[model samples]
Target: MNIRPSAAIRQNYNEIADMCRKTGEPVFLTKNGEGDLVVMDIGTYNRREKMLKLREELLAVEEDRMRGSKGYSVEEVTAMMRNAIREAEGHGTAE
Candidate 1:
């Protein structure tokens, strides 16, 4: 998602420094004999990096279940549900 450009990032030098402190994101700047480009903290740069990790995890789980991953018995699943409900109700333990 594109963040809106600040007036300083658009207007002044000190603005980039001030805004970087607040947003943890960089702004754009132009150098002498150069053109417009973004400026930002390395931390923000690293965090903005993306990967397919989430998709890979979901696909792995689906493949395992389809290929006969061990199944739990109904009694075991029912006990787990009862335990979760008891926890949600703020009780100390489930019977």
Candidate 2:
């Protein structure tokens, strides 16, 4: 993990920012020998948020399945995807 003293932010802001951008990872900043803050580039932060959202959605779906909610079959899902692709391509209407 990338780690830096809190003072590094004030002393080497540009270098830290460059490292975050280059590595696509957060830099852990510590204050008084304890974790203080995390620094990451905007793109990495956004991607992380998207991934977390996706995981949450998947978990909800799994919970629904566990509770006996209806699930789509493989063929049904395939057809739905094809229909969506066609609609996106302006060749079909929403069902």
Candidate 3:
């Protein structure tokens, strides 16, 4: 984790922004010995948001499965995904 005093951010905003873009990670800013804010490039922030949403979806699916919900086998899921892709690509059918 890259952490720095809030004053450092105030003094070197451009440098910190460049670091976040290059590293794809947030820089933690602290004020009065406590975390104040996070700074990150937009693309990194979007990717992190996507990853967190995906994790939440997977957790929900796992919870449903644990509740004895029926689920597709790996091959069934793969074929369904392939069929969806084929339709999306204008191929009309997985067959």
Best by lDDT: 2
Please give the lDDT score for candidate 1. Answer: 0.67
Clashes of each: 2, 0, 0
What ranges in model 3 sit over 4 Å off?
A: 74-95
Candidates 1 and 2 compared by lDDT, better number: 2
lDDT-superior candidate, 2 or 3: 2
lDDT of each: 0.67, 0.97, 0.95
lDDT of 3 at 65: 96
**Model 2 misplaced stretches (Cα beyond 4 Å):** 78-95
In angstroms, give how far residue 79 of model 3 lies from its true place. Answer: 6.2
TM-score of 3: 0.74
Compose the digit string of candidate 1's lDDT tens values, residues 2-87.
23344446466565666776788666554553445677766666666533566677789889999999868999899889999899
Model 1 scores a TM of 0.32
Query: In candidate 3, what are the lDDT values of residues 1-95, reduced to their tens digit?
Result: 99999998879999999999999999999999999999999999899899999999999999999999999999999999999999999999787
Q: RMSD in Å for candidate 2, one decimal?
A: 2.4
Per-residue CA lDDT of model 2 for 28-84, tens digit only, reads: 999999999999999999999999999999999999999999999998998899899
Q: Which consecutive 10 residues in model 1 have the weakest lDDT in total?
A: 1-10
**What are the clashing pairs of model 3?**
none
Q: What lDDT would candidate 3 get against the real structure?
A: 0.95
